[model samples]
Target chain A: MPHDHHDHDHPAHSPPQPDDKVHSYYQILGVALKELLIEKGIVTADEVRSAIEKRDQITPAHGAAVVARAWSDAGFRTRLLTDANAAVAELGYPMTTTRLVAVENTADVHNVVVCTLCSCYPRELLGLPPAWYKSRAYRARIVHEPRAVLAEFGTQLLEETEVRVHDSTADMRFLVVPRRPAGTESLDEAALAELVSRDSMIGVAVVRQP
Target chain B: MRGPHDVGGLDDGPIDPAPHELGFWEKQIDGLRGVIGAKVIVTTHENRRYVESLGDDAYETLTYYERWTAALSRQMVDKGLLTQAEIDARVRVVRERLAASGELAPGAEDVKP
Candidate 1:
């Protein structure tokens, strides 16, 4: 493996040791770039700090809110299916660059998403993708063997249901609007949103009553 | 002609759902990229293309943010925003300062790839 070359200097079969002191080449390069950019008057340090905070502010809960509203409001569901970008904008989380496509799950159709080419996730709505979502295994198998992959996530589907996997791109992203679980009519939007997990929005698992 | 990054639908290992906590340096790189991207210094498309073109050795060997930082540095040089020499000098200064402050481990520079 190409990565093996990085371990050549170490004694063979030695356990990996975590070093907190030395900065790697890429880490140094990243800091240098940031400092150079700030010195060049291209961007301020405050801008970078604020940008990180903004990204951290977005999480799976935001997507859950959208899904909860869709479950309770038929009009919102129609709008979400028709124009996801506009629908999300109504929730004050507008996508500035890419278009969002919310794929709906039904009795006979199950929807899932993957970026075959790269990790093109809806970060604004769901925060950064989980580590598994970007793993080579998930990226390689999700598109072709979705049933097996979903099964690994503890999501079992019936033989009659058709599984659909949507491949995301740089300009287009996907969000799985999972079906609301049964017997949740008494729950309000906030409570319903609480049941929605990050994996469920990625279509690996289904939302369940807790 | 599949890029090294285009690993979809081929035989691979089982999915490891273990989550990794983002370190301080990783978050800073992400923040820098976000700020530069928002300022139109580099588009996400360009970032992806650069990352894809990093060759198989780097694409496979480096972590996600490592690739991003490498690509971002290359993009900065290509765009004439910063020169290679300038970046190298800055790196040296950072290393020296850290070492003088006893933050860098001994023989760390020798072990660098």
Candidate 2:
């Protein structure tokens, strides 16, 4: 007889408790599975830890700093607009094979990025993704109704401002270099970086004068 | 199959301005994912493919790290790096220990891996 013991009458596990605080079955499973992988020597705990540390190194501030420099130095902005990967590397931000694309927002144009396939962002530069970026609602709606979504984010574009939404469907990740607000001609690069919020880099909002 | 994860241009709701605090296990899973990919065991494409094959409900309901780990387990088993029996044993032990300690619901003791 063929060894069919694999399907032995093991009972089903009930779904997670409705206690609301209980970890989901999948979450618990993840913990156990990760342990097994580590035990088997397929990967080291230090490797995973280093990967996490690398992610923690980047923040919205890194992306903001780049945007700030672009604001103060037209040359950098032009280079960023032309070759974002090189421009970001010039700033000593970690570089990988994934291409970085910086889209500039001008008076007549507003750009927003949404990945329809997955929640891919400029992770190497902006660190981890936000909850909303991974939410089904945001992913499904942003591509079609970017204007409405931006409004929800409290970003209202001028009627004349063209809403250009970029669907990051390829290997390229996008960073929106929002237009500098007026009355900020005196602000230096460091001060300008402080004004660049995470959402602004994501293109859901614009950089405003403090 | 057109997975729910491919949702784009579909209407939803407002973004919660609140920040998300990653749970302990989430951090581990995400890091493990990076290490796994760095090892070239599974590419992002393969991971996405596994995620999409998890059926629409699991894909939609599972948290980001949950899906990543699930797909990872799937790939590890597929690649012969680990066995389902070993994984099931560990999962069962974890559930029992937690359930016994009241960390998990008491009824979870009867759960089959």
What candidate 2 gets wrong by more than 4 Å, as runs, is A1-22, B100-102, B105-113
Which segments of candidate 1 are over 4 A away from where they belong? A1-20, B105-107, B111-113
Candidate number of the best DockQ? 1
TM-score for chain B considered on its own, for each of the candidates: 0.93, 0.82
Cα lDDT tens digits for candidate 1, B45-105: 9999998999887777677887888899899999999999999899888777777888666
Q: Which candidate is the best by TM-score?
A: 1
lDDT, candidate 2, A1-210, per-residue tens: 121232322121223234533355556677677788889898887898899888778788999999999999989999999999999999988557578899999888998888788777888778887877767767788888888888889988778889988877436799999989898889999999999998998899888778
Q: Put down candidate 1 lDDT per residue, A36-144, tens digits, no spaces.
A: 9899998899998998899889999999999999999999999999999999999998998999999999999999999876689999889988768877789899988
